[model samples]
Target: MQLSKKSRYGLRALIDLASAPENQYVSLSNIAERGEIPAQFLEQVFASFRRAGLVKALKGPQGGYQLARNPKYITAAEVLEILEGSYRIADEDVSPESRCYAVSETIQDMLIGPVNQAMETILGKLTLADLQRSYQERATQSEDMYYI
Candidate 1:
């Protein structure tokens, strides 16, 4: 399954927020700058994330957005669901029941079920914190190599 720009940007925004100190508010403009997402698009994505209770918005000066929960507590799957609904590899029309012919529902189920599970498994195991940490590590490594 391919993730859209919305989902990808949402994850980038979350990772940026996650890297910040706890209770720190990150403006959409800041997230957009760091994530390379357009400010307008980031705003739209943030609205959905807020409605999903994945993040909360702060008001007034020094105000912005912050995660409602710790990054470690938030899984990639949750972010994807918030932004992309569900991960669907196959459409409903592909089902044998929909086609009015069945060589093997077993085969279809076997194929679809494993794919769905694999997708969920990887996403569930990955957290926003994990992503941020990886980014930080790569940046650090690049810097270290540059000096060598």
Candidate 2:
């Protein structure tokens, strides 16, 4: 399954926030500009994050957003779940009385189950810190590659 725009933008914004100096609050406008995300959309995303306790916000002149906990403590799966609601690739919609019930069950058991499990394993293990490190590495590599 593909990630929703909210999830993609939220994760990118989180990475941007996580890269900031520890405990430093970052303005949503700054993150939106840096990530090329729409400010209004990112604000909505951040609102959900704040409600979910993944981020903290401050009001007033010097106010902004910051991670509620260390980046290493927040998993990609947690972020995705907060933004996307559920992580299952497919829902069990076929009823036992349906003609295609057996086929649906087989697909769920043999394909969807394994794929979901794999996704959970990967995302559950990946934290914002991991993403930040990977992003930094890519940025550094790109900077090292200059056109002739």
Top-scoring candidate (TM-score): 2
Query: Could you tell me the lDDT of residue 27 within candidate 2?
Result: 93
RMSD for each of the candidates: 2.4, 1.2
Q: What's model 2's lDDT at 96? A: 97
lDDT of 2 by residue, 12-45 (tens): 9999999999878889999999999999999899
The sequence of per-residue lDDT tens digits that candidate 1 reaches over residues 84-147 is 8886576335454565446355555778778888988999999988998998898889888844
Q: List the residue pairs that clash in candidate 1.
A: none
Q: Which ten residues in a row have the lowest lDDT in candidate 1?
A: 91-100
Model 2 alpha-carbon miss at residue 78, Å = 0.5
- Error of model 2, residue 141, in angstroms: 1.8
Name the lDDT of candidate 1. Answer: 0.86
Candidate 1, RMSD to the unseen true structure: 2.4
Alpha carbon lDDT of each predicted model:
0.86, 0.94
